[model samples]
Target: MTRLLIGALTAACLVPAGAAAAPAAADLEITIRNVLPGQGELRIALFDTANGFPDEPASTQPTLRQRADGETVRVRFPGLPQGRWAVMVLQDLNGNGRIDSNLLGMPREPYGASNNRLPALSPPRFEEALVTLGPQGAQIQIDLKQP
Candidate 1:
C-alpha cells in the first residue's frame, strides 16, 4: 500500500500542472458569413460536446445577434470554457418565420453553422463542425453555404 501511494504520487507529479487543473476560459471569436437578400436579424449560438462528433450535447450557449450585413461578419465572444465546441447561426429575415430558402432548397436567405461547415452534396455533419477551445478561447472562422 505504501509503495502504491508513492507510485501514484510520482505519476501525479509527472503530469503537467495546467493539464491537471481546469482549463482557463477562452475568448472566442466567431465569424458569421454569407448573407443573402431578405435575410435579416441573425443569431448565433456556440455549443460543445465532449468529443468532436456527429451527435453531441451543447456545453454552452453564447448568443450572437446582429443585423444582416450581406457579407462575412466578425463577432468576438470573450471568456468561454475550453472544450470541443460547435456553432449554430440563423438568419431570421422576417420576424415571422425561419430562414427562407429557394426552390432548389438552397438557402434563399442566410443561415450558417460553425467549423466552417460547408455543405457538400449532403448537409454538414456535426463531426465536420466540431471546434476545440483550449485554455484561451480560440479564433475560429466559419463559412456558411446553403444547399
Candidate 2:
C-alpha cells in the first residue's frame, strides 16, 4: 500500500503544473442591431482567416442561420480558439441563401459586418472587420445597413 501511494505521488509530481489543464477557450458574443424583423432569416458567419471573408459563408469555421425575429439579435459562439475573428451578418429577405443585389452590384438586403464598418462603394474587408478574442473573450455590436 505504501509503495503504491509513493508511486502515485511520484507520477503526479512528474507532470508539470498546468500541463494537465485544458487550454482556455474563447467565447464571442455578437449583437446584431437594426435587423429587419419578420423579414426572413439571418445568416451569420464567423471567419478566422481572409480566405472567404465577408462574402463566403462556406469558408467560415462555423456559420449560423436563424430567423430574424427581432430588431436586435444576439448570438454567442463558444469554445473557439483564442485569435482574431470576423463576423458577417446579412438578413436574407428572400430565403434564397444569398444576398440579393441590384443591377449596379449594390446589396438590396440588410447586411452588416463586425465593427459596424461599411465602406462606401465597396464591400467590407476581413481585416477591417476583425475582432481580437483572447482567453477573456469579446463582445461586439454590428449595425445593419440598408443600401
- Highest-scoring model, TM-score: 2
In the range 1-147, model 1's lDDT, one tens digit per residue, is 999999999998999868857767888887666765445676667666534232223444566677766577778878888787777676776754455656765555455677666564444576677788887678877666654
- Model 2, stretches more than 4 Å misplaced? 1-22
Candidate lDDT values, in order: 0.66, 0.90
* Each prediction's TM-score versus the true structure: 0.64, 0.84
Off by over 4 Å in 1: 1-20, 36-39, 50-60, 101-107
Q: lDDT for model 2, on a 0 to 1 scale?
A: 0.90
* CA displacement after TM-score superposition, residue 56 of candidate 1 (Å): 12
TM-score of 1: 0.64
Candidate 2, residue 93: how far the Cα is off, in Å? 0.4
Q: Report per-prediction Cα RMSD to one decimal.
A: 6.8, 2.4
Candidate 1: residue 41 Cα off by (Å):
1.7
Which residue pairs in model 1 clash with each other? 26-137, 27-137, 40-93, 48-59, 101-108
Worst 10 residues of 1 by lDDT: 50-59
